[model samples]
Target: MRSIVFASGKGGVGKSTVTLNLGLTLAAAGKRVVVVDADLEMANIGILLGIDATPISLHNVLSGENEMQDAVYAGPNNMRYVPASLSPEKMERLDLDKLPSAIKKLDDSSDFVLIDCPPGLGPSAVAAIKSAKEIVIVSTPEPSALADALKVRALAERHGVKIVGVVLNMVLGDRSEIKKEDFETVMEVPIIGLLPEDVEVRRSAALQVPVIIRAPGTAFSRAMRLLASRLSGEKLAIQETKVKKGLFSSIMEFFGRIFGRK
Candidate 1:
């Protein structure tokens, strides 16, 4: 199985959101994908999926209260996910050491195992990083964020974990934002993806649905599909969406054309 961990140096970089959607995209392409919420302290995969409560989670497996398979739950698009417990009691009993073995059990069944690691260089993050065969750093187009990512890259290199490039999220293409080449130059890792900030993503998360499922034709979803194709080495089809132009659309188009703007 391809064990890939998605990590970030700083929080609020959309690491969990990108990881979840990528797993779903892979699953949609007919690959057996499993996403594990390894961010034990602030596990939000369940919240993103609109799952308020689960009987068993990663905490249970680590605490030896349940098997890894028992913690796996069904998700959309035939994808399976291992959500982390939100309970403070379970968090207290979490055994980070057992995480590796617990993840190992899923190797036989899954083609791809995507771990959503916690931010920073904490013990939990280190444990998750060491457990993965490869790591993908997620960052924004900011020096501060990239600086933190560099630290994570260093940590992964120290452990000899293969760096699978970086996923640059929430790219707005503003002049103030760092260029792609600069990011690569600073981190010494290629940018594997450039996910744009889309309002649809926010709407989907509010509805407890992934953007890929809720709005596949949107730019964000298309980019996600392309990213999945690049990783899977298969040219997955991009779904095209047709829009009906109304009076509002015509007016906007006319103004956009006149002003040479969107």
Candidate 2:
């Protein structure tokens, strides 16, 4: 199995969101994908997948209360995810040393294990990085985010972890944003993907579903699919009919109409 940790140097760069969407996209293509929410403090993959009600989480596994397999939960698009507990009490017992072993156990059954690492180069983030064989850095197209991402790249290099590439998220075509070429030159890594600043991403997050499933036709989803394809080395074709407009879309449309918006 290939273990890849999706990381960022700073928060609000949408690393977790990117990880969830890519995991789902790979799972939808029939790959055996497992996403682990390694962000102990701010664990939100369960919320994003709408599986927050799960009692067993990564905290249980890390605390030695349960096996890793016991915390695995089925997620959307045929993906399996290991969510971290939100309970403050459980977070305290988390043993970072157990993390590498927990991640190792999933290698036999998974084609790709995508770990949603915590932002910044903290202890938890370093543990997550050490557990994975490779890393994918996620950052926005801005100077501050890029600068922080450079630190992450340096961390990855220090550990001798192979960097697959960098993903540029929340890219707006405005002149103020750093160009793709400049980002590559600074990070010393090729750009793997570029996700635009799309409203659908926010709408899907508010609805607690992946944008690819909530609005498959949106630009964000298209770019996400392309990103997944590049990583998996397979063409992940768009399937809009797979996800129909649901109550969330209806409600948003109602509000849009009432507010005289598109």
Candidate 3:
């Protein structure tokens, strides 16, 4: 299972929005995807998805009050959603030790586990990072968000989790101060995606639907789909692949070996 955690240091960086869209995109592509609202403090992920039923909140799972399956809610398009509890006690009193097993169980069943982590590098963020196979840093192309994103990148590298890549959101596409290329160079990680600032982003969130599902034709959705493909290891004709054929010499050898038996 591919465990992808989406986190940001500052608020309103569109981290949750991206997580929602990414989940929908993966599910649309036939991947068995599940989203865990790891942001236990301000877990409003259910709100964005229009999930009014409480079902089984994360509080129950972590507290041993219920099994992980009990907390899992099937979302729109059959995507599974695990909402975070707004209860203060659950956030403060919940034991971190029990989290690993419960979360691992979820990961084992899902093809892609997308975590909507809380803002800031707090205990929740640390715990999410510790459990994930890879971390995706989301930022809004602003200095404040960018700085925090760099910190998250460092944290992922320090913790030995692969920094899958950094995602730049709310970009203007022509912004002078925010060049997408500089992000990769400075952070020492690949820039997996660059999402433009679109009003549909807010509207989709307001409607509890990911932009991809709500407006698949929009530029935002297209960019997200491209990102999904890249993350899934899909090779596009234009994108560069690591293993080059060395200008045809290796290819000739492969062909030669196949037909040389004749």
On lDDT, the candidate that comes out on top is: 2
lDDT of 1 by residue, 212-231 (tens): 87788788888898889887
Q: TM-score of every model?
A: 0.89, 0.91, 0.85
Can you write out model 3's per-residue Cα lDDT over 1-262, one digit (the tens) per residue?
9888898888888888899888877777777889988887777676676555374688778777888888888875567888877556666557666665777888667989988888888887888887788889998766777788888887888888888888999888665656777777777878889888889988766655567776777889889888888888873222111222322223334334433432
Q: Per-residue error at 141 for model 1, in Å? A: 0.7
Ranking by lDDT: 2, 1, 3
Q: What are the Cα lDDT values of the candidates?
A: 0.87, 0.88, 0.77
Error of 3 at 16 (Å): 0.4
What TM-score quantifies how close candidate 1 is to the native fold? 0.89
Residue 155, candidate 2: Cα error in Å is 0.8
Model 3 is weakest, by summed lDDT over 10 consecutive residues, at 238-247
* Reference-based lDDT, residue 2, model 1: 95
Query: In model 2, what lDDT does residue 19 have?
Result: 96
Model 1, residue 72: C-alpha shift (Å): 0.8
Looking at candidate 1, the ten consecutive residues that score lowest on lDDT are: 240-249
From the highest TM-score down, the ranking of the candidates is 2, 1, 3
How well does candidate 1 score on lDDT at residue 15? 94
